[model samples]
Target: MRCGLVLVALLTLPVAAGRADEADDAFAKKLGAIVRDPRQSLWARVEAANMIGKIGPNAGAAAGDLIAVIERLRPTEQEPLQEAIVEALGQLGAPAKAALPAFTRLAGRTIDLDLALKQSRDAILNSSDSQEIDALARQLLSRDPSSRVRATKALSDLGPVARNAAPFLAIALGDADADVRRGAINAINRVTPNAKPTEAFVRAIAVDLRDPDANYRLLAVRALGRLGAPASIAVADIDALRSDPDPDVRRAVVDALNRIPIPQLPPGVTATNP
Candidate 1:
């Protein structure tokens, strides 16, 4: 009886596995049907696109169909469909790489391509894997105008893993476009917590501190603080900044000094006293 029971348990395993696979197939089929149905309203189609993205590469066979839909609907005056297509491409992940060349070619002919590329950047940046992030960053770096913006955004999204892109980011600091330069500086400040601000960057911020651009000065001060205590003593201008006319700049200096882990005072003198 024991032998018979063991034999029966082994026999049922394949059947159970098959049932699970069949269920997944049925679900995929249903989603495909919804996505393909012309009678569906634009909103419904957008919803279907979102569902497909959540399903991931399980819907690989449907990639061609989805690409076609994105191409056709991209030019439509409807915003919802365009949004849906962007979301769907993100869901497609690396599988969508095959479609990129075509997308790039199309991008050359129209302004809408910029929006689509931005959506792709958002999707890739939000992905969970470092490999995907790197791949997307490399692709974006190949484009003009978009390259600098996308790379900056990607570095921000990548957080610590973006250390590998340091060389490229360093070059971006001198970009002709001020926005790109600002973004690169912001990204570097974010990715390199231990980074000592370069002399050029320090001087740049110093100049901006007196500039009319309040936002520029604000970002510079914030970046300086994150450079931590090591940088404070290293920078020649730190003493001067302690007395900056801008209250915010002075506050930032104090905060930066505090970040440096100093030894306890020998006697009565306290951190606040200094």
Candidate 2:
């Protein structure tokens, strides 16, 4: 919520640069100052870098400055700062195209790092190619992790307007690549926070809940919790998971059960309070 860019606690937060609670001239100026100042604390710099993306295309004017900030930090594993800066470039879209070479140089570091760079680079270069939206959406199921990652971010960037892609994204929750799985989950949440969970969505989470990987079970439980009322469709299956051997999965199930509210009883029915 802080960046308005991410919702699933990805390395970088979500950006709202040109969307809700738009970032303005003065706000960008303040962040730019912090980003440019060598004396600033690392967290402050990270926050400033993120805000630039939240400022979206409005921060286009600061693209050079943001690039400078990246130049100052990218020589090593500057985790938080790298995420923030690349996320900022993603927000700026095509305006940050000048930094594509830098991103290209930065790719292949790690699955996460490479995906982040590719996402931002593509966002800045081809995200607006409307005709390709369908192709990208289908790509979410690609066996290639890179293709899946790109599709997830693209669909995510498209937001709720990407109604058509939601099912694919939901299915991606079970991807073997942890990064794709997480990115797909993030995209699904962002695209349908208030909508009923599609049957496909519920099925996808169900599959994850059965996964041998505890992480998938944990993520699926957390997803059911986030889906709230709509996720009640999986109540029986989720309830059965209460005894899951993994403590984390059990905790997640408890959290999910707490999240899905009970329906109202009939007037003739006697309801007892817990």
Candidate 3:
């Protein structure tokens, strides 16, 4: 039995190592072809770019080539090609940090801010460095209103690393635009995983919960869940909702209660709301 186990391990190691090397080599070759083949279809180049992004930081050397391709294409030239570049840059992570200045410049140009925001968010999420994320978050915060909205959404996507934007996000929670407020609330929830709702915010959310828009109420419920048990406003409201005339509200209330941490409840507090 021992001998068989040893034999199996020995046989598997070299084969696994060989497969890894083969994959790496194949990726390198495909990357080279994508950069060098002018006659390649735009879709093929885009596909190769997507593959490089999936390959991660090891594809750093391909950054220059990818940037060259991006520069050659007009803003409206090829959407697939542009998306591929964004994904590849994201995959490159810290190695692609050098491209940020260029990206910043391009973002300031006549190009679509929405698309630029998407790319920037991708880069921020893929970045290995916290400093890089901080810098990008700051830039996004200060950009145009539309970009700020996108940045807030991206920061939410980055989760706790975006804690720096909490103050700004809180301010956004009161924005005149409902969309902006929603985005801010989302960012706040992301940064404060164990967040406790302030009485005011809780009250405001409760009012939103009764808004004519079902989606707004749904988001408010989700935010309440993220706030944990101290979100008494949500707990009380949801408990009442358990017997609500509307089936949807009752279901939402049940789901919300399931998310609260029972152990975190104050002393004497039962798992069941009174």
Candidate 4:
């Protein structure tokens, strides 16, 4: 009786696994249809992408469908969908490799897709932690805005241990995209705020003081304040913003100035504050 029970259990295992695979494939197929349907609402398509990612590699059948959806969209209509698709592709890991070329082409169409693309490729290759960090650092410097945004965010999530990416992040401070610049500052604050601020970094933050966006100016001042003494080079620049048109910016400027230890500069040397 014991031998018979063991035989039965062994026989059921493959059948059960097969059923599970079939079910996963069915679900993936349904979700892929939703993703491919133009009539679907943006949120619906995004939710479908999320579901495919949640299913992981078993939903590999949907990889080609997801790529098709991305390739079909015009740039004007892609912003909301592409990010979600890129994220989903990353989650699919090895099965999504065929989509790599699509990711590359999409990256050229926008600045936000590169980081996600790199992440997807990493997933396909199953990169190690160190490799991921190295890849992200390289992506941080990518001219693709989306790539830089994703890279900064990934580094920020890694916390202070990712301080090595800080130098690359400094370059992002002057990025054309405000979100990328903001992400860089936020990452810097997390990764190396306690370390001595770099001269180039201070100059970059100082430039933000004159940004047309009031909120970005506020964020820049707040980051400088957090750096305290290291950010003294930007003291004069912060002081100039004391009379900014925006009241909130004026208040943050005051707080930042108080935190930053102002230094006296020599007459012959001009402060590179801005």
Candidate 5:
């Protein structure tokens, strides 16, 4: 039995090691840098994206970098590179969900582009692998804010499957860095839209409505709104922000209030809304 187990382990070791080697962030970052370097040949950039895609889940951190390249090339007549980037995002699967919004904007432009976008979206939603999700969740607690931001972006793309990372994201909502805080709320909205909003979670996000940065407040309100009826717990707080000093924040607050529906409470249980 021991010899048979040893044989099986040896058989699997190479394949596992190969994937681990590809997951190296340094390698993925180098490919991302190549994809973004304008001076590089067009084919070189396309190849770089293709390489990153081939790296699979571990290369998820490069999704934002690839999206930046896509945005820069979308207007130009670089159809081939655009297609390659889109294909790479599809290959990245669930980790590339962050690209769906960008693909939505690029839709209606052409048949090929639309089809590619649909395929990528399907791939992202159909992905069942938990390994990538686990890796990004660990990155959520990284000491570096940039790493946390990338993890949040990737986790947000995961839909309900990222529910386990909610606690980390909640803590991130209070991060000292505005960008990290913004990313955290964005992640919460996308990652746990249907999750039962706990008092602590709801309160953690509600605190953001009073954040010093107007943009953070606006994003927090939008995140809460995205929670739909589940976020009714924050309705009173959001309503109070209707007269916020920042016009955009106030506008978002009103829109959020509109989005949150009246929750059905038990008999004798009062509604949380004011």
Candidate 6:
């Protein structure tokens, strides 16, 4: 009787798992049908997209079809659709890498979409596995822009772990996509805030400060400020640029310098208190 019971239990396991998969497939099919059907109200489509965002990176399988839904709508009508798709793609991480162009096209074109797009772009590259995140960071040099962006955004999301991604980010700093380059520089600064000014980690932002693009200069200055006193070593660099050609860049220089503290001496090298 024990053997009979064990056999029945084992047999039922596969059926249970299969039923779960079947239910998932049925749900996805129903969702796709609803999203693609014109008869579905805008609110219904919105709900479908919201469901995808809730699923996060687990929604990679539906990324393509979801993107298709966005493409079918006019750009003027894409804000709400963009919000849902952005959340879904961000959650899907590396799996939705192929749809980056679609995401990029919408970037910076609309005020509402821009903020979500900035935050959403990083979601496409996130992963629970540190190793997977590391590998994705190494793809910054991929000939495919989308693939490179995937790595860039993933590394950015990894924060301090991006210290391991410095080499790749250095490469990304030279990428043609202005967004990727800035993102890489931003990640390097966030991860290496306390790194000595002379460290190679600061090289990426150093390049950005001198970059002709004011946006790049502004980003570099913002990072320097975020570093506070540990980054005080750049005082000469910042002071020299206080009269920068761009008003925003100059303001950042002042703010960054002002934010640096006076008491951040190197470890084991204490300074006398005033």
Identify the leading candidate in terms of TM-score. Answer: 4
What are the lDDT figures for the candidates, one per model? 0.58, 0.72, 0.63, 0.77, 0.74, 0.64
Ranking by lDDT: 4, 5, 2, 6, 3, 1
Q: What's the distance in Å from true for residue 54, model 1? A: 27
How well is each residue in 184-262 modelled by candidate 5, as lDDT tens digits?
A: 8778878887657666566667777887888778878987887777788777677777778999987887778678886
Cα lDDT for residue 173, candidate 3? 65
Candidate 6 Cα lDDT to native = 0.64
RMSD of each: 15.1, 17.6, 17.3, 16.1, 13.1, 13.8
lDDT of 1 by residue, 50-69 (tens): 76677665554555666666
TM-score of each: 0.40, 0.42, 0.40, 0.47, 0.41, 0.41
Candidate number with the higher TM-score (2 or 6): 2
Per-residue CA lDDT of model 4 for 35-100, tens digit only, reads 887776777778778778877788888988998988888765857688888889888877777787
| Residue lDDT tens for model 6, 1-274 | 4433432333243223234545555454455555555665665666666665665444455667777876676677746766776666666667667767787777766786777777666665444345475677667767788777777777767677667777677777777776676677666656665655443435455567778888878987887777676566555566666789999998888788778654454565432211
Q: Candidate 2, residues 1-274: lDDT per residue as tens digits?
A: 2432322233243444354434455455556667767676667778778777876777676677777766666556566777788889888886687887778666665677677887787787664444356787879867799989988888888777676777788778878786787788778867776766677667666667778898888888888888888777677667777789999888888888888865554455332212
Q: Write the per-residue lDDT of candidate 3 for residues 156-202, one digit (tens) a residue.
A: 88888777767767666666656666677667768877766666556
Looking at candidate 5, what is the lDDT of residue 257? 69
> lDDT (0-100) at residue 10 of candidate 5?
33
Backbone steric clashes in candidate 3, count: 0
Worst 10 residues of 4 by lDDT: 7-16
Clash pairs, model 1 backbone: none
| Overall local distance difference test of candidate 3 | 0.63
- Candidate 1 lDDT (Cα, whole model)? 0.58
- The per-residue C-alpha lDDT of model 6 at residue 53 equals 61
Best model number under lDDT: 4
In model 6, the Cα lDDT at residue 154 comes to: 72
Judged by lDDT against the true structure, how good is candidate 4? Answer: 0.77
